[model samples]
Every structure is written in structure tokens, then in C-alpha cells.
Target: MPDAKPRLIVIDTDPGIDDAIGILLALASPAFSIAGMTTVAGNIGIETTTRNGGRLLAFAGREDIPVVQGGAAPLSRPGPEPLNLHGENGIGGVALPEPVRPPESLPAAAWLAEFLLDQPAGAVDIFALGPLTNIARLFIDNPDAARRIGRIIAMGGVVHEVGNVGPRSEFNLWADPEAAAVVVSSGLPLVLVPLDVTRRVRASREFAQALRVAGKPLASMVADLVESYFETKTHQESRPLHDPCVMLFALAPELFRLEDLHLVVNTGSTEEAGALTVDGNGTPVQVAIGVDGPAVLDLLARTLTAA
Candidate 1:
């Protein structure tokens, strides 16, 4: 028999196309029992992101997981305009019926803080796939609760590659550099899945074909998005399954190689703004440098289709 799985987790995300896949991965994996989902403004505005998050849960037949809307802008920078990568509405331009379930009463930051506090020490793992604004605010409001988390696995930064948003920053970290700084310096155990590793991994044409062959509506939708995203971007034949890598690290750490390093966010200078500058000194956080890409793709495909 497989070992018992962890019980409590909270996902803080901004419903990008890849974010949808990450959410489905968490809901489908028996390793985690999702406590709730909190939406932040990274891929789109807070309202749209929260609604999209709720829609995914509703589509997955998991309306029981409450969704909460959080910070509309970063702690420092003015909110970034939505990117076209996930379409104007986010979620791969594939709109489902409007979600019937209303979001939870509390804002995302508050819900995240209170929920973490309510769980036993080291019991809750936070998977953040967007700007860290909400998570930073939670730490500021409830430091003790933030400290109680077992670990934070995040999908941001560009430690060893050129930034996607600028010369030095990835989109998520660039969206909220101040928030990124706060969370990285919060003294919690953190595992960072930066663009360095994610860029090396891609969902190839074969993988997309396989997903399409699954004949499931959600899988087909994702496959189509991957195809569209790749075709529109220069030299990009495949889309990186970015956010899912963070969840994969948490659910299957053995699939990755991790190194401890000091990461700093650059909020100044127009040229390198939002860059995550890692110094190999000071308090070190874990950063993923490599992964079993083919295996991860297989895992993602099977999990999404698992009954």
C-alpha cells in the first residue's frame, strides 16, 4: 500500500492557463487535501482571477473548496496590466459557464493566515503560483501563522536565464517584486522553482497530442491552449508547464535537484526590474536546478486523467 498523504494545504494562485493545470493536479493528487484556494492579481485582476479559480473548482466538481480574492496590486509596484498569454479572461480563452459558487467571505490574505494558524504546525504546505503579494501580507499580519507552514513551494524567478518580462525578471516576480522579497526573506523553508529549470522543461507536441487523445474536455482545452501559446510566441514550439513544477516539487521532491542560495528581488532600474538576484551567501533557500522532465509530463498526464 502507498504511504498516508498529507492532509492540509492552501494554494495561492492567479488562474493562468498553467495555473489551472496546477490546481487540477493538486485536486487530483491523493497526496494533498486542499484546505482552500486563494486568488491574487498576477494573470489578471483580482476579481477575474478569483472567479476563474472558482470556475476551475466548479468544473472539477470540487465546489467544497472555498475560493477567496486577495491583493489587487503588488506591495510596491503599480499593478501590471494582464498578459495575453492566458487570454484576456485567463484560463486559456476557454470560458466555462459562470461559476455558481460565491467566493468565501474573507479576503485571500486573511483566509490564508487564519487557515494556516488553524492547522497543526508543519502540517500545511503553501503552493504559490502567482505574485507573492497575498502571501507577504499574510506574513505581515500574522507572522506566527506564516511560520507554522511546513514549507512554501513557489513558481517564480529566473535565476539562470533571461527574464521573460524584462532583461532580468520573470512575469510573476516582476508583477510584485516587493512581495517576492518579503516572502523570500520571511525565514520559512522555501523551495523555489524558477524559470531556470522550468524553461528547460517543455510540453512537447507529442505530449499535447496525447492529452488531446484523452478525449476529456479539460485536457483537450489545456492541449489547445498549449498549442496556441506556443505558436504565438517566437521560437517557442512548446509551452512550459511552469506552475505545475512547483506542485511537483512538493508532491515528488525526489524528481528534482535542489540547491540552497540567497535570492534577492530587484525592484528598481527599468532595465532589470523584478529580477531575482541570487547571492550564494547569507540565509539560503532551496532552488530547483533540474528535473526529470519526461517523467513529470507523464505524471501530470496520468494525474489529470486519474479517476
Candidate 2:
């Protein structure tokens, strides 16, 4: 019998530390059957992110899942070389074997389009944890496939809180605001996990210690990475689990408050490159306003620690 879960998700990401946690949580949970994962450049370059995706899957013993490389740079933007947020390798300086499985034959955008088309109508949910370049490209090339996707749960933008990359923009959207503008305006059902809510959820020392004691290798690694990242940032005592929050929305909608509103991305303004400006007039996309942070942490710890 097929799984009764309502979601067939495709992860489009740049495997930063939080992205690694998000992927583990999704793969660990029975609520989702991750169909495929496509990598893009964001926290790091496409090459590193792609390699990190493969490394993560291998670490989770999910080598069977295909990891395809996507766009190396955002549309109309210069390529962003890998950042050091997740250490040199984007995995907390932890080294792992390269994936035995090669990427899909086609580029990520084409592969994503093909997969969405092959799935049953409204069966696929896109979990975009990085820039929107690949997704935007996919839509441009295959409008039919774009329409087939059930919804998109993205981690970007800043409605009520300060943006991470700049005063008005977050890293993911800042990487390619034009692409973000296209995706949000496409009228697709979107569940946005903006910084407003994500900023409020923190992974504290207590949480990190608990994760380390959980006895799961992945959980321990995640904890270490979070701890390291937390040290570098202003909020050293508490770090936002930004990317994973998007996956948590998919795994447990009850953990958050969803408000449907119209959202726009600021691509033209130099001062607000990746700003996710919400339309005052009610729009149709679902935006996450609040989240049960403690509950989410518990869920993440449990899932990542499970044998």
C-alpha cells in the first residue's frame, strides 16, 4: 500500500548547516517521501552545495536518493563563492565520503520540471531552502510542470524582523531577488517561513547539549554545527534554526500559524534587494506568523536521534 501522507516533496537547497538539519528531519520523518533533491548556490557555491547534498544523503544512509546539481549563480547576479558560515565544507568542518551515486543526467531545473510533470496532480510540494534561481528557471521553461506542484514551502525574506544578509534582505533572496519575484508572483500556493518567525525560534545551549546526548551521529553533528555557528553570530546564546523551520512547517503544520497574504520580492531596489514585502491587501499565499519553537526543537531532536 502507498503511504497515506499528502506530500511528495522535492528539496531545492544549498546545504548550509540548517539545510542539513532540514534534510535530515524530512528524510527521517514518515510524513514525507522526498522524491528528489536539487542543489543550488546560496550559503555556498553550487559545487560545494551539491557536494554537501551528496555528503548529507550518504551520511543519512540515503545514497539511493538522487542529488542533482542546479544553477551555480542566480539569474542576473554574479556567482557567490561558498561562504564560511558552515565552515570550509558547509558541514561544520566535518568530512564525509563523496556520494557513490552520481547526479541525474539533466540539470536541476530540467529535472525538477520533469519530476513535477510525472507526479500526480498536486502531489508534489517544493521545499525551497535556498535561492529561487532554479525554481524560477524551471517555471520559465515548463509552465505546465510549475502548475502541477501542490505548493512551495520556502525559507527566505523578512517581513517583520531584520534581514540576515542586509538591513532589508535575507541571504537566500538577496542571492537572487529577481528569481524570487518571479516565483512569488507566479500565483503558486506558497508557505513562506520568513525571518519574522524564524528569528524568534532559537537553538540554545540546552538544546545543543540535548542533541549531542541523543546518541545519533547526525544529530550530534548538527548540534556541533549549530553550536559553532551560534558562536560566530551576535546571538551566541541562541541561534535561529532558519532553514529547518520550513521543513517543520511541512512535517507539522500545527506547529505554526499560517496567514494567507500577498507577498512581493524587491529586486530593483539596491537598498532592499531581497526584501519580501507583503501586500497590505490580503493575498493568497500562506505566510507563517508564529511557531512552537520548543515543540519544533523536540521534534527535531527526536527525529534526528532516532535509530
lDDT of 1 by residue, 185-303 (tens): 88888888999888766887777788889887667656765665665575766778899898778877887889888877777848576687777654578999888887777787887
Global local distance difference test of model 1? 0.83
User: TM-score per candidate, in order?
Assistant: 0.94, 0.93
Model 1 stretches with alpha carbons more than 4 Å out? 216-218, 228-235
What tens digits encode model 2's per-residue C-alpha lDDT throughout 1-307?
9867646789999988889878878887778888889999988888889988998888778988899999988888785556777887886776677887888889998998888878788999999999999989988888889999898899988877778778878888888998888888888778888898888678888888988887778788777777777656755678788999988887788989888777778886585898877776534578898888888877788877884
TM-score of 2: 0.93
Off by over 4 Å in 2: 1-3, 230-235, 280-283
